[model samples]
Target: MSGAANPALLLGASLSAMAAALHLAIIVGGAPWYRCFGAGEGMAKLAQAGHWWPALLTLGIAFVLLVAAAYALGAGGWSAALRGLPGLRWVLLGITAVYLLRGLAPWPAMLLQPELRQPFWIWSTLICAGYGGVHALGLAQAWSRL
Candidate 1:
């Protein structure tokens, strides 16, 4: 069973890995690290008070993203188990759609808030859209092979 080499899976894996690392830092670095990410004073207070639910939630998301990336790669034939999974192509499609949706979802917020027009927000949104586009292309390539 061969499929086109899906670069999107690799991209997702790399991004997810970085996000997981950041999540780990957010979980352990406490108030100072959290503050650097523009989490606001309330979160800083929560971190200082040893309440890490918010970070935990982010960490959960980061972990799931990592898993999805791994699964994507595996389904691309990087692993036997992953290749054997049912509906691998459909799963890839879903992931692509999700990334695309997330990338576009910020547009409304950016339009409504002047602060979101800053370089940071623009760059982040660009990256998100780029990632989504890559994943979409990868999904199409892999599906063609299927």
Candidate 2:
């Protein structure tokens, strides 16, 4: 099936793209934004100290999101880099599983002292499930055609 005709692939790609953009925004938002997102005062203080951990950590997360986006796009046969790889189906599955695990596995640890990230955790879990499921479905369809 054509990439555009595949709803699963499209949804996966869209989610990945959205995640990547959000991560990039976090990087751009710097310390205040990070702190606002529940990163803690230590991180904010570090940012004020010119440590750049806020940006660096966000960059790492952004890199992962970018990789996920590439994987999603590749699910649709849109990337030459992914097209030639061996065991691509397994790779896609692995990526999907990672996303699912990240969102579903994190505990209800307090973001700061007594406050838990209830809403963020809930939303993140759902988003990751959606992303993982979409990619899995798309990869399965693509593999079937192969």
Candidate 3:
């Protein structure tokens, strides 16, 4: 309640969270479906049945929640209100860092997994890094405001 909250921090967090969610949704959900239904009758049936719908929904929900959480943590007086919770901010920052590393790191193991194309992995990694940098910068600004 007493601490100041930076608007830029919240916006950055929100955008980062959204990007992460999108990456997860496509990579995680699409891979499995593609693996299970690789150009066959089963694949055709699954596609016709729209099994991917749930995955898309999940991504949408995650995006909303992440954005809301960012607003809560960084927008208006919420950040100030929760400023009493010192560890929370650090934990969020840690989560952001972890996501960045996971998204960006080049795991040799992935090369063996034919289901995931190397090009796709590289692109996703880059996107994650970008998102992480934005969020990190935002967090720093927010901390300073506090």
Candidate 4:
């Protein structure tokens, strides 16, 4: 399986890594779109609401995971890059679960609210489904190759 390099797997890993990097950059850059996630604008609200530390910690965790993902992508080599990552399959599995639930689960009441409907969850659902599916397929292909 080491020599059975699957380009799709490598490409999928690269895509996931790039997305993580972009997400981290957005958080660091104070992107307003992140307001919905308690990162930028929401941080102020969270601070006043007395839950700032937990939210901040969550964001920090996400950043760490993104960095780890990036490192895995780099370590994953040319022939079997995706398969090369030490524990990437588990990470991918976790990501897939989150995305699937976010995208396919019954819509939450908060997301149904008129004001937040447009940008909060609907778009995320679509993005998560598409992106998650791509990664899942990549994982599946890579696993099969392995």
**Leading candidate by TM-score:** 1
Give the root-mean-square deviation of each candidate in angstroms: 2.4, 3.7, 6.5, 4.7
Candidate 3: tens digits of C-alpha lDDT, residues 42-117 = 5445545677754565566566547435543643245555555456566657756765786666655567776666
Clashing pairs in 1: none
lDDT of each: 0.71, 0.70, 0.56, 0.55
Better of 2 and 4 by lDDT: 2
Residues 9-83, candidate 1: write the lDDT tens digits. 667656756767877787788888777765667877888898867677768877877766765776555666667
Tens-place lDDT digits, model 2, residues 1-146? 23444567667877887877876786677678667665677887787677867778877877877766666666677765655555556777888788777666664454343555656565767778778778878877787643
Compare the candidates by lDDT and give the number of the best one.
Answer: 1
> What is residue 30's positional error in candidate 2, in angstroms?
1.3
Cα TM-score per model: 0.80, 0.75, 0.51, 0.60
lDDT comparing candidate 1 with the true structure:
0.71
For candidate 4, the TM-score is 0.60
lDDT of 2: 0.70
Misplaced by over 4 Å in model 2 are 1-5, 107-117
Clashes of 2: 0
Backbone clashes counted, model 4: 0
